[model samples]
Target: MVPVAPTVLFLINEHIATEALLGEAFTDHGFDVETFEVVPAERAEDPAGHVTFPDPAGYDVIAPLGATWPVYEPALRDTWVGDEMQLMRDAAAGGTALLGVCFGGQLLAQTFGGSVARSPRPEIGWCEVTSDRSDIVPGGPWFQWHFDRWSLPPGATELARTADSSQAFVLGRALALQFHPEVDTELLKVWLAADSNGEALQAGITHDELLTRTEELAVDTAARVRRLVAGFLTYLAGQPRPS
Candidate 1:
């Protein structure tokens, strides 16, 4: 039988550049991808509040890209959180892969009964991640930009960590990453230009610092992210179809 094209849903809560880069990456991996810009029309309003989509059962994978706070704040935290959680659980239950990046990772943790709250110390810029599961996230430095942290969900395995945060987690075929291994220079520039790095960025971190780290290891880091995503897809394909 000819293999069916696996449909992948790319959630662009905000950060259009990131949405494009991630979609391109997955497309290169041989999956059909679609993107949605879910920013609410009104400020301080829920973006998803005004949008609608069918069940996640239609997709072979659900990937929520990292975004600026205005995108995830009042909107995602309120109106969209539950629905996204349901979508995540449904995808996992249906044996479809689920990969969450940054705030996307927080969403995944919460879906699995974990808590998402401000970290003791907000991690900004590039930081070294020690992989607890080397098979998933190979140890090295991964880019981080967030003021929050998450508790690993029940039955979830932590893939990586830093001095201040649990950087990555995995549950079933689901994978959650607090850092942006998928971050490319263009997106970085746009994100910096918008001054959306949150409290961490405001704490005196410099763009030069981030550029230096990412530039020094861009090739290697991309390779690690590839390994991580490939591992998740392998797990997803191995799962039995739901009865």
Candidate 2:
């Protein structure tokens, strides 16, 4: 009998970015991919009124991707962040692997007894990180676009970091990251096009410069993502899920 391949559920919060290269990495790892947009485009500002999520334990891996909104904003916390945290907690309790990115990492941090707040300085464009666990998270010129940062959660081992904040951590079977390893030139174009708030420009990174950097690092970043996903599945997924 043919075995059922493992599956992944990638939550696309606020439509800030799609799975892009992340989805491709999962597919290459032999997992079926499901990208779900938890926040509706029309109601992104008010996602509290109507949002529903499936059982996180239903998939082998669940990724809460990056987002435009902060997880700690009072309005967001009241409407959806609180509920999503609960779901992630439940998923952790039930042996489902989690991979959190940026805002998603912030969510995991809060769910696991850490906190999120404004960063001293925004990290935009491509920057190199320092990773202790080079086997899992490579020190990279990874894409980063965030104004907030996460404190390392309890019982989490920080695998990577920059001067500003924790770049990557592992809480049981979950891996949380502050950088965007999924970004490629095409995906970055989408993110840059949606620069309604001039976030990148304000951070001192021009669109052209970031795009150029992204294109230059495309091959290496893609290889890094594949290695990351492979390392996560081979090593972390074998352990018990986060509680």
Candidate 3:
């Protein structure tokens, strides 16, 4: 008999981004990965009530990726924000593991009774974190590009943090991460180039400098992502899957 591969859904959101290294890492770890976008392109500027997210059934993992929107905005909360949060809650209740990245992490925190707010100091480019579980979250510079941070949800364990905010947390099978473990030079190029109003410049990082650093760190970053996924899978192994 042949072993069947586990499936994962990568919620790419409305942004022009990919799972990049993160989705690839999961594939290397033997999981079938699928991509979904919650906000339709026509409604990118105002996604509220424009989309209905897919029901997460049969997938072993549901990973909500980064986005350009803030999770705390009241306008969003009334529409797709509430909708997606409900989806996350439903997936969690049904035993699908949740992995929320950046904005996704903030949303996960919000859904799980925590809060998301603008950080006193926003993080961009590659930033270092102090990890309580370094074997999983790691301590070295991980890619970050968000101005918001998540308050630890009830029953969630803090895995890593920085002075600005919580960097990573875990609750049951769910892993919420503030950093981008899947970022690579190409993806960063796509993102920075698409920043119409110069988001990186506003954050004090130049496009050339950031991409240069990414080139220097790409090798190590990929290794860290690989190890991070392995550690995460091992951690998930100990949790109960929905029957």
List clashing residue pairs in candidate 2: none
Q: Which candidate do you rate higher for TM-score, 1 or 2?
A: 2
- The lDDT per prediction is 0.73, 0.87, 0.86
**Candidate 2 lDDT (Cα, whole model)?**
0.87
Q: Write the per-residue lDDT of candidate 1 for residues 151-206, one digit (tens) a residue.
A: 88989888788988898888877788898877777777766776653454576677
TM-score of 2: 0.96
For model 2, residues 1-243, the per-residue Cα lDDT tens digits are 999998999988877667888899999988899988888688766666435788887898889998888899887787678878887988888889899989898999988999999999999988789999888898877889999999888799999988888899998889999999888888888888889889998998799999888888888989999999988887787665545
Per TM-score, the best of the predicted structures is 2
Mark the regions of model 2 whose C-alpha exceeds 4 Å error after superposition: 240-243
> In terms of TM-score, which candidate is stronger, 2 or 3?
2
Candidate 3: segments with Cα more than 4 A from true spot: none
Residues 2-53 of candidate 3 have per-residue lDDT tens digits of 9999988998776675799989899998999888877767777767674578
